[model samples]
Target: MQKKNQLLLVVLCLILFGTLNGFGQKNQKNNENTNLKTSPKLVVGIVVDQMRYDYLTRFWNHFDEGGFKRLVNEGFNCKNNHFNYAPTSTGPGHTSVYTGAAPATHGVIGNNWYDKEAGISVYCASDDRYTSVGTASEAGKMSPHRMNVTTITDELRLHTQMRGKTVAVALKDRGAVLPGGHTANAAYWFHGADEGDWITSTYYMQELPKWVNDFNASDAVEKYKKPWNTAKVINTYLESGSDNNTYEGLFETEKTPTFPHSTPNLLDKKKDFEIIKYTPYGNRITTDFALAAIEGEDLGKDEATDFLAISYSSTDYIGHKFGVNSKEVQDTYIQLDVDLQNLLNTLDRKVGKDEYTVFLTADHGAIDVPAYLSDQKIPAGYFVYDSIKPKFNAFLQYKFGTANVVKNFSNYQFFLDHKVIKNMDIEVAKVQETIANELLNYKGIDRVYTGHQMMQNNYTKGIPYILQNGYNQKRSGDVLVVLKPGVISYPRTGSTHGSPQIYDTHVPLLFYGKGIRKGSMVNRTEIPDIAPTIATLLGIAFPNGTTGEPIAEVLE
Candidate 1:
């Protein structure tokens, strides 16, 4: 009886020991998979306006070691990165980047859209509730209220219980506001020649900080008035076409769009500060503001991870004034490379090398000059909606016996007068179809997707799929228009981009610094992958509306 009792005791002891050992192993595995021991001190997101993936390659030989080359050689390069949706404008692109969602979910269809409910046009970041906090201009009336979903910045703020700071700076309001997300500590944008200062809306703070006030007090804009010249020899710009092309727009101060133009010549008498943005010096001032924010805000000093979002808007302005393949555009990029190097050096000193993570990308890429394409015998041309809108209204008037049925036409979308249609007892779907069919008859228009069709299958494939991803029920138009590849709706000179083609979709994405692997990824990746990758690195939940999967290879 004693031996049997001892055997039972031994069995019970063994069982208990096995159970506790198993529990310990399980907890250890959980900790290893999650709860990463450390995160980067700061996350710097640099967005260059109108940057195409090819730019990095086209100007590869000219780039320095610390600028684009440092990010490409020492960092992870996403060679196949692209924007996933159509109508890739500044507002939608920036919102999509930080939200990890498309415009359909983020509610930023374009830079500007016709509001059916308000019966007027609405700016993407404009809000009447918020007034300017730093300046006494109408510029303060902008906020991120239009954003329908949370961004990665918002996720960081929530995870850290609002301890982590998020700040953004840009030359344009939308460029600054959209990427900072809703919970940013401050989002600053350039206020123009009159104020010549970095300004923020009341949505951020009741007043500007002392550092910002002092920075604004400095005559930064005036300092760049010396003159604009090429960083390299004029003949070395072989990648770009000859200067003085018809595709380039001349500045107010110059007779020809040539080299060595005076910066003061470009400044408006009343709004001389506006000329700063037209030159590459605008990017310099923007970089200075970002550096100031870093020091003034103590971005990387704390235990919690912070984010500094910077967007260089001069590229877009320069691209719009001069075609993609001009000496001016080439020179702007060359100068921009130096500016990037300067910012990186500042980060190295302030945040420490490898202490922060940096991701450089673009809001949207631009298409080549339409006139240049035509000169090359390519099937490219401009589609002027001004002419087509009047004709379409006449067609609708003839068919429905009514005039002014089209309320608005912009962003390749049509806004019909719903109130008038309802009052006249006209079938909304039929009218939409009629307009879509009429639009198909116009030149450079590839296809048209009516609202009803989008609702049917959610446009799950092909061009319609791209259109649907950009459409929002409350904000989008009744019909979506797709242009033929290489065609635009802008003037004969300069260039623009708002298409689903490779020219507008393909953009450069480079991830550098902490928790990132060094190498190149050839696999196709979209813009939405960025925010989730950052979240994964931080060991935090992805942004609330994230539809993108983290690139497992990028995380350490």
Candidate 2:
């Protein structure tokens, strides 16, 4: 009887130990798979603001091996990628790049849009409810609420249950806000003062992290106090047009268009800091801040995918001030190549080479200055804003018996006060048609279609050039105004985007590092397709409202 009882106790002990051992092994396997499923240790998204597709080759000779060369030689380069929408501004560019949806779907149509509901112009990143954490004004009160769709960064956070870190740094607020997505760990943008060091709102965190405070307090601005100067020889930049030309706009303190800028004291003044937006160093500062964020956040450290979005804002500034063809633009690219090399080197040291993924692309490209194009007899000319608006107003008065039919005209978008039309009992659709017809008569105007007409028309054959790209009904204007060939909307110093021309739409898309293929795709791909591609690469869910498919060549 004693032997039987002892045998029963031994059997029970054996079963309990076996059960516990099985559970432990299963848990260990789960933890291992969880680490594997977390995706790349780091995903770095580098967006060069206003970077043209051709510039990559144009400045290729000057690039260091580890920077742009590493991306081109080692990564999968999408040669013919482009933004597939009109009004390709900075805000929409960043939003689309990160979200993998165009302005039509993302809801960030322009940097500052005339909100039909509010009846007031709303900045893309502005949120009145959020107070600035770094600055006094609401300038820092920005968020991604306006962005309707999820970004790749948002997906990374979601997949990790918000354990992974995501940080976006740029010189511009919209550049930072849109790419950081709704649930970013932190988004920092330069405000251009010793005190204005990268500001953010409480939306991300209540207080600045200790690392960020230390970085800000370091007084890095003192480095630029030694007088701004060109990093390369002027003559070596033979690819660009002559400096100090009539086409190029003058810098604030520097009289000539050439470099060796001696305006360090200008740093103390707000107006001078505004000029910093036009120089290449603005991008350097942006890169510096990005590196700081990466180190401070300890991104990609644990079992969560991390993302760091860095946008080089100087290209847009240089494009605006010097035009696309100026030596300034050329030099900026050359300098940027070196800066990119440094950034990549830092990434190699910080985030192991095969462990992280990097994708580099542009927001939008810029047109050659209209003045330069006209000089070259290329038929390019500035849009006659003064002539067109008054004519439209006169036509409106004739049709509706009032001059206030058009409320605002900017970025080729004409917003009509529907309230006034309703009160006056005027036919809004008829008025829009009349304005469209009149606009078509102008020299620089090509074709004009009412928003209703574009929505209904499926016959793309011989459709207007501007309407060739995808257009979403919700974000576009009441009347889609198409500009004639070789016509730009910029009236000020230099060139502008927003046209459906190849110059504004064509941009580079290169993917390098872990899991990326080493080949090129010349087939034309839209910008919205980028998000879906990233989602597939990381095995994350597709962003809502995405109609794009991942590039089949790059995927495994």
Candidate 3:
């Protein structure tokens, strides 16, 4: 009996010892995790308007080591990244990035689409019901009310019970409003020239914050008046076409599309700050405002994460004015590269080097000048919608006995008048079919799909799939049109984007700073994947209408 008792005591001691040892290992693992941050203190989303993926490659040698190169080398690059929907324009592109859904779900079909109920074309961000808060002018009369769903920023705010704040800044109204989402603390846009100021709508606040007022009052914008010039010698711009070419559009008062052009000459007697949109100075001022917002808003100052959405709108205006292959366009990008370097350096000082995450992308990519492509034996041409619209209306009148049945036409979509069709005793589906068939017979028209087809069928690939992704049942037009490859509805000079083609859909997607994997991915990725990746990193719920899955390789 004494021997058995001694054996039982030894077994109990051994079991107790094993239990303590297991807990010791578990406690040590928990201690190590204290040093590993699950989320960054802040997130900076940079959307460069009209930036193409090829710009990173073509301007690589010209880029500074600290800017685009740093983001690509020290961070992760989605090389085959693209916007997943058709009609890749500014409003829809920005909406898709933050919403984690396509325009079909978000309800921003185009920058300006025909509003059948409103009986007029509606701008994506324009909301006349809201008053201007920061400016007396109508420039601030805009909000993100058109978006039908939540964004990643909105989800962040909800996850923290409104402890997380978001501030959005851009040169264009839609640029600021859409990315800021519905729950943002502030969304500001620059309205310049005579005023030389930033503005916001009443949707976020009743008045501009004191810091924004002080920043606007300062002479910061005066520094950018130093004439627009090339960052390097003119001869170094060999990647672009000739300095003087017919493909590029000229300034109002200028004759050539060359650089070193007077910034003042571009502006008239009113000294309208509007010309700034066409210059690299616009990007500099936008960065300045964004930095001000960071300090004024006290972003990244606490444990809760904050968000800053900065959109470089000048790049889009410049790309539209100078086309893709011009010395002016090349110089703007180089200057933009420098501005981005300054921004990153500031982030390091204001927010710790590893405390913030950055994602740089573009709203959309522009196509090369169609005329220029034609000269190179490329199969490209212009589809003049203005001239063709009148003739198409006449054709509709001949077939349907009334042109009034077509209520509106924009974004290559045809909106029919249901009331008029009902009065004419015509079936709406029949009208859609007739219009779709007629559009297909037109030159430069590749394919046309009726809204009925999109509602009844699920397209898995090709242009039909993209159009379906962009189609909204209540807001979209009855008939959707697709242009042939390399065809654009634009002037001979300059460039435009609003296509499912790779040139417009392809844009840069770079991830940097904390919680980002340092590598490059040649595998395909889409714009909608951005918000979900951000949601995954933040350990928060994805946007309410999210249709995209997070890229598994993008996070650390």
Candidate 4:
């Protein structure tokens, strides 16, 4: 009986040990599963138009902790980021950032390019195949049809099996449409003036969502009726030029370009809401709308990763009107810093402090006003298209026996009338060489490459490489010209971009949040690399036409 009782006790002890072991193993598996997630709940991409890399350093002291500084201190900062191609305009810039390819591969050669076959200027985002969804204006008749490859946003949607949602917003149509890609749930741009509404095209949806309608119905534009002024103490704006300067372009109603400009005062002249774009209030409205999107769309709410692409276009508008050194430009960056802080705060509250990933970059940087550079004893001058166009046509006429042989000289390239050249029985390659040779003699022209040269040889460095990355064989022109450094084809007052110069190519690139390393890199990185880096962070496929390799340092 005693032996039987001892055996029963031993059996009971064995059963208890087995139960405890099973429970411990289950807990260990649960913890390991939680640690294995490779993707964030959401990705936010912010592109500030016409923002130079110097702007970050110029405004560094004025920036608050949560905006640019937050991105720099706690995030990975790529200080040497630049655009790898020429003609770094908005369309190509944004497309390159998202497609991981230059204009050559992605096919957004310029904001507007002369279509050689079509014999007409083609806007990059326009598509007559679809109608406007929100308003009856031509602004909504835009899509991503011009882009030849998939964007990172498009890849995310596919990786998630269509469960991930992508929504893009901007003041300019191309800014929103290109980044949104072919499969975006919606892409909206604001139409200012008498009809101030956020609009989209039928390519995404047939009607504006109820939330978008509600936003439009509200007095969102009305709140910005106050006059524009500096965000901080005006005296502290030592980083910029005087408030009144001849280098800055004036509003139609005003003579002197100074501070505290009135958007409403200028509204009477145009009778359109377009005047607001010239002020910092444009960025504010954009931030407000972005916040609304986060709430309305319920982003970052579930397992499926979402994406929000927001482009701040007012910087470009203001930079075009007021030179990069003007007080107004300085004021705009200060205001933008605050808006970014608000955006980051909202992400923390809505998406959790570490649940989302955010990257801030620029479409392209702008050159200093050529006039200003001249005054400062720098080598700068204007490349007037008005004067150069007629001469170029005359040369073509003199050589080919007819001016009609050239369709147009657009995006610093000559779109030769191919049919006309074939009809005249002239060798097209000979025509390209003859025209390219003559362009070198023009005052501002630095060098010229024929279509044949662009197609045959691959360039590795200098201006030739930059231009090569921008050239598209089927879509580009016959003769491509590169203006000398500090030479621009724009008016004297405001600055412009679209050069291989450092001022035009260098722009800020920052990555922060979930799965990103906290560090800084000063090595050379191009804008096209952004898309692949994001792809790596999200553990997704690279863009279809990607020519850039991902920055391994950015990944965790």
For candidate 4, write residues 132-196 as lDDT tens digits: 87788777888999999999999999999999999999999999999999999999999985887
lDDT (Cα, tens digit) per residue for candidate 1, span 333-410: 888899989999999999999789999999899988988998999888888877776777688889878866778888
Worst 10 residues of 2 by lDDT: 459-468
Candidates arranged by TM-score, highest first: 1, 3, 4, 2
Pairs in clash, predicted candidate 4: 193-272, 193-273
Better of 2 and 3 by TM-score: 3
lDDT of 2 at 8: 97
Per-candidate TM vs. native?
0.94, 0.90, 0.94, 0.93
Which TM-score value belongs to model 4? Answer: 0.93
Q: What lDDT would candidate 2 get against the real structure?
A: 0.78
Name model 2 segments beyond 4 Å from true.
1-38, 193-196, 268-272, 422-427, 459-475
Candidate 2 residue-wise lDDT at 234: 76
| Global CA lDDT computed for model 3 | 0.91
Q: Candidate 3 residues 262-373, lDDT tens each?
A: 7786565558888888899999999899988889999998988999999999999989988999888888889889988998998899988889999999999999999999
Clashing pairs in 2: none
Q: Higher-TM-score candidate among 3 and 4?
A: 3
lDDT of 2 by residue, 1-556 (tens): 9999999999999999999999999998997676466467888898999999999988888777877888899888899988877777898888888887766577888888777776778888998778888778666888888888888888878987888888999988888888999989888888864454778988888888888788778866446554556667777777888766788777565678776665565665543455566677777777777778778888767657788899899889878877888887887887788788888888788887677888899988888887778888888776778876677678777878987777776557777777887998868787778778888888888778776666666633333423534355665567777787678777646767876677888999999887688989899887888888888878788777675679878754
